[model samples]
Target: MFFAVFLHVLAFAFLVVGRTLAPRNVPLLRRAVGDNSTSSGIASLALDKSSGSYYTVLKAGDSYFRVALDTGSSDLWLISSACTSSQCSKVPKYPLAYKSSTFQAVNNNQTEFSASYGDGTGVSGFVAREMVTVANITLKDQAVGVIDSSNVTLDSDVSGLLGLGFPRLSSMSESVTNSSPFFSQLAQQGKLEYPLFGLSLNRFDNGSLTLGAVDASVVRDVNQISWHPVVEFSPFGMESQESSYLQWVTPLAGFGTNGTTLSPNPSYPEITNNASLALLDVGLNGIYGPYSDVSRLFEAMDGARLVDSEGGLWAVPCDTKQNMTFTFGEQTIVLQPSDYFLGRTSGSPNLCISWPAAQSPSADGVDWHIGTPFLRTVYSVYSYGINNVEAPVIGFYPVTNSTTAQADEENLSSILTTVKFTPPNSLLATPTDTILPYTFNASVAAPTTGLVSTGLATSTYSPIFQAWTTVRSAIPTIAPSYAVFTDSSGAVVTSTPSIAAVTLGSPPGWTGPNGAGRSSPAPIVVTVAILFAALGQWIFCFIV
Candidate 1:
């Protein structure tokens, strides 16, 4: 009896140690793919073309909600059942207090939470702690915002947003309770094997979001991934006093069209090598950059001209074949014409709006906002670094080849041929309206503030503005203009018009029609140890 009890105790010890030491591998799932249909236990990402967003499933309490994946901001918020706002009514909401047994309001729901985005959308609510699960890994008592009010423009398909940015960017961190973001919570709880996550966003098919470690299957060549150190300062500029990095800002080595590089704006001389700073944001659908640089970028393309000087909207010939290149470190990622073209305007089927929109430095001090147009070209990995032991880095691996780009270009050309539009002989001259350069005032000790444009049509006489308004009227399902800004006071402001719907072609530099193939995850060491321990108990029983 004594020997048998001793053997049982020994087996239990081995099981406990094995389970604790084993790595946790969680898979992100595409919304189109069923929740139970993860491929080899790897997360799959899905793109919603209507909203121009990518999202994944997140489970809170007993219910699951689809949340948009945003790396630009740092906060995980969901509309609550208590919310009666029209925007909140459109999407799925978190369960009521009694509905979920695990839901607990922090500070008796007195602590307020608020955050905003570059696109002029914002959310405000109370803080709560609940068991949140992504892929299969669960973070117990994760702090999340129970949004009671919001001006965020969300489609019916997505419940809310899951921000994968740093802790300093989190509004919850600045709240009374001072809670960390969801990803940071996972690390603090020792749930991740590695302190990073990988994202694979595809235009044609399903993509993936791998937590803890890189997904070997999606990467064509791991060794080729060019990793860059994350910029330490706030991408929004020196206005804020946050002492840590906010967004996934990285160094942009070069940018040009058809091998001709554009000169960087001389106003910001702090950047090295005339290179601009780029924020890799998955939430934003298109690219935004300094007004001067963007103006030069469009000038290089045939029949391209600034359509709206104040709004920074540009138009180009639908049939233009210009190729743009963005260099980062030693890696140069190229984008074919099909990738940058948004689509033909409703009023003018021949004219197309360029995706690389221009923004004044006063609006957003960041030199560049690299969105899906650039991200879809390669596989991206974001490393948070292990508790300050390592520095945060953003790595990119090329998945698309020249052959794939050629095929995509041909496909776009075929579509454009059906629409009749005349090409301009020379580049149209820009408007005479002057846009002033951004200047930092060191005398005033205040947080950074700037006008966040809605990037939608306003009351303007420009033909492009009329065309944009016509398109918005044609699409009745599109949300109305709503501007929510996050400044020093955290005020929610209203704006007019949102982006008009555009026809989506194959994204610029996709690997193939179906994207990369999947591979089985490697065996865990803990599983092997457990099996060995169980076998030993059986052998000892037989010997006795």
Candidate 2:
């Protein structure tokens, strides 16, 4: 008890006085990134120690920025010489003002940009054109956001951010009138050998980001790519009542050992959508679902209970033997207990937390987002239609049957090197931060679930404060958008949320120090017989 108290107090001290300074400058990287020898490119991957977010080194014009790749939102933005906010001061910023040759500034009111996230991080800036090098492609005059102000505190950990979402969702979507994003432009220009790419990651060791080609080495059987079409998202929310639409969506055919389909049956529908839809998001870290559906799902496992972490996360007994299997299209995935029991609380018999987060960041309520923990077990190819078979499709292939794989599955780089799209560039791959166990968010909290442009369409703010204010006032009332179900006879039906939707109130805007992949359990103050007992637990938290 004394140990927990002492660390909690120390953590609080760290939060107040411990500020990690970001590297203020790196040379305007005049050199190109990756070898310009091949049609495809490969980037090494790493996870952030503090935030548990993933990022890779990317060269933007004259400088190399460690940028996080986000699939939930669009816009390649970085702190810049123009930013004057406190958040801006801590992140690595490019001297756009001094690097005139590399930074081509665009200053029209229309060119100025802004974005807000569910966690309340917002960046307001102007759009500019600059050369960007990723993998093997040296993209010229790519649109980038030079943040002039921000509410996000990046702790200088990452230098910038890269958006991997659909172009229409880009922060500059209005400026280009919804044109193609940087990667899409590569596809349009035929610079890449293929229209799509694949990312193979491991909990430990290293992973690869294969652009323009799916890394065949990661999958046991490349022929087993189970392709499923993506369902369109319903922005208005009402359209879901008649039909369902969600980003990267697909029908969840059935569940259970007997393969019970989605139905009016209360047991399953309570925690799951009546409609049976699940979205595949690489940006989020765990599978999420509405409160009721997830509650029901856990009920099946003895000792599985919901614990309200900062973002409504769930925890299950570590000894749980429940085998949760999911069906995607024509394929089935059986999850080992390790797949869901992601973290543990300290003690002789540590408490294991489940990997599934039980809430959605959006006002739209909860639905499932298949993220990092789930993807690690399989090989996923997020495909864009260059072959013309379909515009956007998700292909899944099982790659592991391990009961518990705490480390990387295996380095298939050697196998990938043999069949690489083009003789790969000999660019350097740097090692990243150490991956830590779940530590009661003795760290931070985070996620990027969807596009943040709904409220950005019209906003004129003065510096950082007003910019975040405008963003908060703009979040549209969102509720559970759509649902899907599979009938016993194998027929699939999609439906809308039955609850009357209410637009949520304006947000607090840019929750301070937004942590994208970590959890922040709400503070719990427990009392013991002695005052020392309280102090011990508080400080003990920091010990982790």
Strongest candidate by lDDT: 1
Tens-digit lDDT string for candidate 2 (20-133): 221111111121223543266666555543333456666676555666666666578877756778866665565653443666666552477887654435678788777787
TM-scores of all predicted structures: 0.68, 0.62
Give the per-residue Cα lDDT of candidate 1 at 496: 25
After superposing candidate 1 on the true structure, give the runs of residues whose Cα lies further than 4 Å from its correct spot: 1-41, 97-99, 117-120, 176-178, 234-242, 271-275, 346-350, 362-364, 403-410, 413-544
Per-candidate local distance difference test: 0.56, 0.47
Show how many residue pairs clash in every candidate, following the order shown: 9, 41
